[model samples]
Target: MDKNKRILSFLISFFMVISFIVPINAEKDEKNIFKEILKDDFEKNSSIQEIDSAEQKIYMVGVEGESILELLDQGYDEEKANKIALDIQNKAIESIKSFKNVKIGEKYLYTTNGFSITTDRNTAKKISLLPLISSISEAQVYEKRVNNVRNILEIASIKKEYGLDGAGMVVAVLDSGVDHTHKDMNIDSDNVKLTEEIVNGLKSKNKITYGKYFSSKIPFAYNYADDSSNVVRDTLKERADFSHGTHVAGIIGANTKDGGVTGIAPNAQILNMKIFSNNPKVPGASEDKIVKAIDDAVKLGADL
Candidate 1:
């Protein structure tokens, strides 16, 4: 009977060991498969060329978290949803900061739960192993496509039919820069206006800095490319679209009472989120900058 008891104990221990090994091996296999898929995706999307492993390039890194829409569907308000995403991004960034060959740049939460990083291909593959990271993709460049809004979309008829003047709405325009000082943009309406002190301050200074010139027409403004609040056009020599942002803003919210060029939604307030660098060599807006602008737009309460 003692011998039978000893045999039973040995059988129990053997089974327990087998169970542990199976699970660990399965988990490892799953991770390996995931990493392989990531590698395929990285190469396919990025069109990566054979180069030194040490060379770095900009890549968009997605984080593991609930998206803004998902959070809202789960009953969180817009602000709370954004905050949660921001927290997830921040935590993930902190966890991976010490990793070699990775440098975090602008972080996004609202529109996209991710951050931009400057890292080489090898480090990016390693980064995919982290539980905090969900995806990695090469950044793409985008150019502005000028549109004839009124003729193409027939916005007047739609506005007339729907009686939509965009009152009580905030519109965010992501472009090079908005000439906020344009007479068409300064129309008086029910939207919030710039404070007297701010106007005086802008007028008194020889140069305007960040966050000082926001008027009632253009409430919130930021230049994501330059990392400044000055959204005014610096020069006209850069591109023909130097006044692109201002022109777009005019189309959306120009409410000149004296028969000036009127926009489709003259009542809507404008939020300036400039993404273009205006550099002749690097003419188009980078994906990272555009993502950052959208993230900021959501945080700043853009209705459109």
Candidate 2:
């Protein structure tokens, strides 16, 4: 029994040794392969600064105009321009051979096939090369209109007391499309519970509770004439179709958090109605669609 136990322990120890040795050899082999590959391709030049690296590519910044001027000064006429270009290109290629990640730009003119150079400084500096230029940080939001609407305090006060802010209300605007991605107008913001729905044809009904748009005058007149030939109501909806709808919508529904523009009711969901002269010259909504939309808004429980 003692001898059998000894043999069993020996076998277990042997297997353990084999397992450890196998993994070590495998890791060593991989390291050697990587080193060999890197040695064959890597080049270092003082003028070429490496900015970023990836497994398959490396981004580099090289002295601009170096190759072009050198070739010209060396008396390589147009006949040798292609050769000179090739040579300079080869130099850049050699520099990046060992780099795991590299991106070249168009101006390099001498990148390997499939490699292109990018000139943006933010991109270049990220990889460790000297920046192409000084960095400037500008506020991305629309500053002019943002500064004009500083009465958010009053708006907030109104919101707290009435719960009347924009809850259960639908404000429609007709204008250039809202920048839905703006910080102020982003769906997650607190000032408004905004929803968007496109009003395409008169027959199609939107699923959302409230919506509106800026439409043209010609369609409104046509629909009115078809129904009763009564020009009066056609003209009223026509008046609403004008740019006034857009301006009113901006005041009533534009998201203020976007830091560009603020609306009187920043929380109202805007419905964009496009009934106008498709050609910007004429502004009006189709009377048929306008009536339908107003009826739809009523069904959606629109406060405005």
Candidate 3:
């Protein structure tokens, strides 16, 4: 085999072994193969920054500006601009996958420059060379900042006085599976047996519906699934995600007849549109999974 083919063979072999033994971590990126192979180029090439082992290996690739600008200059609306940008990003992602034998994690069209894709840093660098791509960098994962909401919304007072607790609303939580047993987070329903006298009296129906995106049959995920297959829910939070979705759901609509903690919208319903999981260690779900979940949520009549 030629030199490039030999390197490809080595990468394929190494990734195949790691894919089996090591669980993927969504927050961490793997070693950059191209950077290692093209160490000299990676250094001389101004496109990619020096490899920082401590940084998350994931990368965000931007779409070329000319396409979006053309759409804008042609008197296209904001919606059209957004659509064109997404199309460009998709093209970039498809080209990268075809050229590099790599998997793209997600695409972001909401970015000002166009869209973004997540891959190991080196694969991102390779993608940057594509004519359609603008730039590639680490995927920035932001933490949801929380400040006191009581002053802005007066949720406690609303619940107490106006009885404005979310009594008739459906909220779809696109996240990791909820614990379904947390005292403060889970709403008491038929599935669980609560010891509290108040909770036992009310025949509360289980509020959360569990759905997994990763374990299901999809070409992007590493999971090998066929017909008659479903992903098992990880209720223990043993995985890397650490119940972020659960916490978000709790804030939205956790209630207790069992004399436990109550969320602001205690009466609201939670739809567990689970997209992220620990099994594959993906940072996030693919574009298709998220789109499908949102479609499902809309069909299910999600108010939020």
lDDT agreement with native, every candidate? 0.64, 0.34, 0.46
- At residue 206, give the lDDT of candidate 2: 22
Off by over 4 Å in 2: 1-164, 174-184, 187-246, 258-261, 280-283
**Which lDDT tens digits does candidate 2 get at residues 236-264?**
44444333334444555455553676554
List the candidates' TM-scores in order.
0.72, 0.28, 0.45
Clash counts for the predictions, in order: 3, 38, 1
RMSD score of candidate 2 (Å): 29.1
Please name the candidate that would achieve the greatest lDDT relative to the true structure.
1
Lowest-scoring 10 consecutive residues by lDDT in candidate 2? 137-146
Task: Report lDDT (Cα) of residue 33, candidate 1.
Answer: 39
lDDT of 3 at 37: 40
Better model by TM-score, 1 or 3? 1
* Candidate 1 structure quality by residue, lDDT tens digits, 45-76: 44333445567877788889987767888999
List the candidates ranked by lDDT, beginning with the highest.
Answer: 1, 3, 2
Total clashes, candidate 3?
1
